[model samples]
Target: MMNVTRGRTPFLLVFLACTGLLAYAYYAQFQLGLEPCPLCILQRLGFMLMGLFALLGAIHGPKAWGRWVYGVPILLGAGWGMTTGARHVWLQNLPADQVPDCGPGMYFMLEYDFPLMDILREAFTGAGECAEVDWSFLGLSMPMWTLIWYVGLAVFILWALVVNSRGSRPLEQ
Candidate 1:
């Protein structure tokens, strides 16, 4: 239906906005010189995947099975973003004494032949660097802000998917 078709444009816009946010993150990293922790990098990766999937979904506007297929990556990326954001939030709230010691850089872990599982475990468990509060707004840190964004995006995608699916059903008189 026309309503479902209209939803596709908003999907592209929302994803473009997300892409802009990631651009700001990069600006903070390069221009402002805020080094991203491992968890931050992981969150960025999730956003990247979400942005890619959303862009494709917008361009293709695939129907039925195709939309469901697109939904898979979007959900996965949003889930990944939420998981990493939650971990970062937990680390930030920990007491100084409870914070884990800093580990080697991500490059070190990957380059040193560490097992993929070990790398993921260490990243998720976090370290001293991951707990730092380098940026904040309205008293919430970057991770907190990102968590909020991921939640909103996930909700929007779900709502749009449901609307589109319903459009395919025959209406009762």
Candidate 2:
């Protein structure tokens, strides 16, 4: 062992937790029975990118550029999350009789690889209807949470990035 101390563990833990969440979200959609919309896909991308940045920072040590790398995904993920949340809000605001079609009709995503493209295709085109909120937990709908999480994740990522950046600068003795 390299004799890693307690101080370093928290950062590692946070990285692992984020990575796990991203992995689980993707698995839930692809393996289980959830299909994310375009915005959902964007969120996933954000998570994945963030995870990658964190992993690099953790393994190689938080370097000069590492903070910016991490921040990029965090901001992107946050933006995507907002879009998803807004989409849901739009749907919620619509009248029962006037709900627009939110169904995925993909002739684009299908142009990629088989397994993922299939999954992507299903994600957009297969979800019965986009406007209909199919599920909710506690008092909030999934999209609502997605929105909250997006804003929250952005803040968190920024915090993490700042810490990493500060840590990167050597202190004057």
Candidate 3:
């Protein structure tokens, strides 16, 4: 059996990580002048959802089944982020001629009163802007990094779930 902390440290850590990621994203957008496409915006929302769920779970500190209630949304948010990240990566890898045409910006769509579903459909289909690799680290683009982060966070959540499932007792006195 695994020994787990009764306190909400693990969940708190996850929340903090998500917050840090979002903070960097804003920094990249504002300071670095990286314009986020619609898909990027969606990915940000995914991170926000994950962080929100993690914060709530940490605050509630529920055991057993309650963890599942929180875990599901966190996983869902990760999955959403992964999906968008994958799409963005795919777009980036597409040949120049094969890339999708650039579409209207999300703000423009909203201001022009485009239907909600149409906006989502266009966003998911991806635009030329999403394919541009304006930033990279260790040869991996931002979307690739985000994909990795989502996978890592999901795995961490799973491990925390298993460890914390053992008992209600704190791992340390």
Error of 2 at 50 (Å): 2.4
Give lDDT per model, in order.
0.83, 0.57, 0.87
Cα lDDT tens digits for candidate 1, 1-173: 44433446645865796798799999999999999888998899888988888898888888765776776788789899999999999999999999998888777887899998887788877557899999999999999999998888888787777767776554658
> What TM-score does candidate 3 get on C-alpha atoms?
0.90
Task: Name the better of 2 and 3 by TM-score.
Answer: 3
Local lDDT at 147 for model 2:
71
Each model's TM-score, in the order given?
0.88, 0.61, 0.90
Worst 10-residue stretch by lDDT in candidate 3? 1-10
Query: What alpha-carbon RMSD in Å does predicted model 1 have with respect to the real structure?
Result: 3.2
Clashes of 2: 2
Error of 2 at 137 (Å): 1.4
Off by over 4 Å in 1: 1-7, 111-113, 168-173
Question: What's the true lDDT of residue 19 in model 2?
Answer: 77
Write one digit per residue (lDDT tens) for candidate 2, span 1-173.
33221233423544675677677677767787776655456556655655565566566554455456545754765675576567655666668776654443433455544467565545434433555664567977666766766676667666656655566533458
Q: What does each candidate score in C-alpha RMSD?
A: 3.2, 6.4, 3.1
* Top model number, lDDT: 3
Error of 1 at 59 (Å): 1.3
